[model samples]
Target: MRLFSTSARLLFNNAETKQMRAQLDETLKLFKEKVSKIKSDTSVTTDKYKNIAVDLGNGNTTELKQISTIALRGNNINIVAFDPKQVKRMQTALIQKLGVSATLSPHNTQTLLVPVQTMTGERRAQQDQLMKKLYEQLRNDARDRNSISSIRQKYLQPVRKRMQKKEGESKPELKKESEAIEKLVREYQDKLTDLYKKQ
Candidate 1:
């Protein structure tokens, strides 16, 4: 009997993407058979296998027993004869296979998300700290901008008006300057709007 199925082409969708899958199947078969023999000999205990508990959201948890057979959703945890140390070795060998499986089928989303979730969580705490720091920086920047705007309105404009009066400039020059400033402001606002829309 064939130890591993040769339906890799069908599983992966593209008929050409079978090389990695074939290698994966061969490796898995060897690993599984070896583990099964060890278990049968009473030399290895089930407890030797590592249990990686994953949060399934809504207060549910899934224990990943074997590295090769990654479970998708609902009642995911299953028992396998492999030990934790061997499980790690299997993980490295099957990583590319896992990636290919995800790319071929949208149904693998939940399964793929599990490994990704694990990887992301390794740095999630650090990312949260960085995010808080960024938020504080932005808040302080906005406050400084508001302070500058208040100074311009409360102090700078009145001083400029007094200087203009002392210089004896008529309404015509003031009207031209005001119109130019308004046009520039409108142009800048339109540009900002366009940029926002693109984003």
Candidate 2:
């Protein structure tokens, strides 16, 4: 009976540890997703322009990619409207969206050409500041979500309640588990820091 009881206690502890690790892993996964979204939003890619919404001047909006085919030629984005009549409206919308950066092709009225802007000194500084702000916000969000107290409230409390209902079971080794959780959080934090530094 004594051996059986010890074995059961060990199994319960193992299960609780696994549960905590799984919760922490889920938190890490969400943080990674947010980081990826920020990187995608900041990247200068054709896909980004394809998703831009153009106001049709009638209060209705259409996605640029839906109305036109977009392709990258060298460092320029070539957008060709499928319907010739929509060309002028597309041009106006593109100009309104991209300012002077978008221009109608001289030879093709149905086509627009947008030269990709180089990261000049001013733009580079602006990008750096924006990235810095985004990185800081990500760090703050992760910190809030994975803080020790937050983890205790969301994950540890349930395990503690279960342990309390068991007869003669010693208090859960929460200090050890807390240390393990902290280590996992730090690893993810380091990964976020490295990602920011690489940007």
- Which prediction has the highest lDDT against the true structure? 2
After superposing candidate 1, which stretches have Cα over 4 Å from the reference? 1-166
lDDT of 2 by residue, 34-76 (tens): 6566555554568767767877777988998999999888767
lDDT of each: 0.36, 0.65
Reference-based TM-score of each model: 0.26, 0.58
TM-score of 2: 0.58
Which stretches of model 2 miss by more than 4 angstroms? 1-12, 51-62, 96-101, 119-143, 146-199
* Residue 122 shift from truth in candidate 1, angstroms: 25
lDDT of 2 at 90: 75
lDDT of 1 by residue, 1-199 (tens): 2222224212223332243234323433433354345333332223322354433347764454533344433322222313433433333323433321122124432232222222145354554454444333322333443221222233235435834673444445445444443443344334433432332
lDDT, residue 82, candidate 1: 33
Backbone N/Cα/C clashes per model? 0, 0
| Clash pairs detected, candidate 1 | none
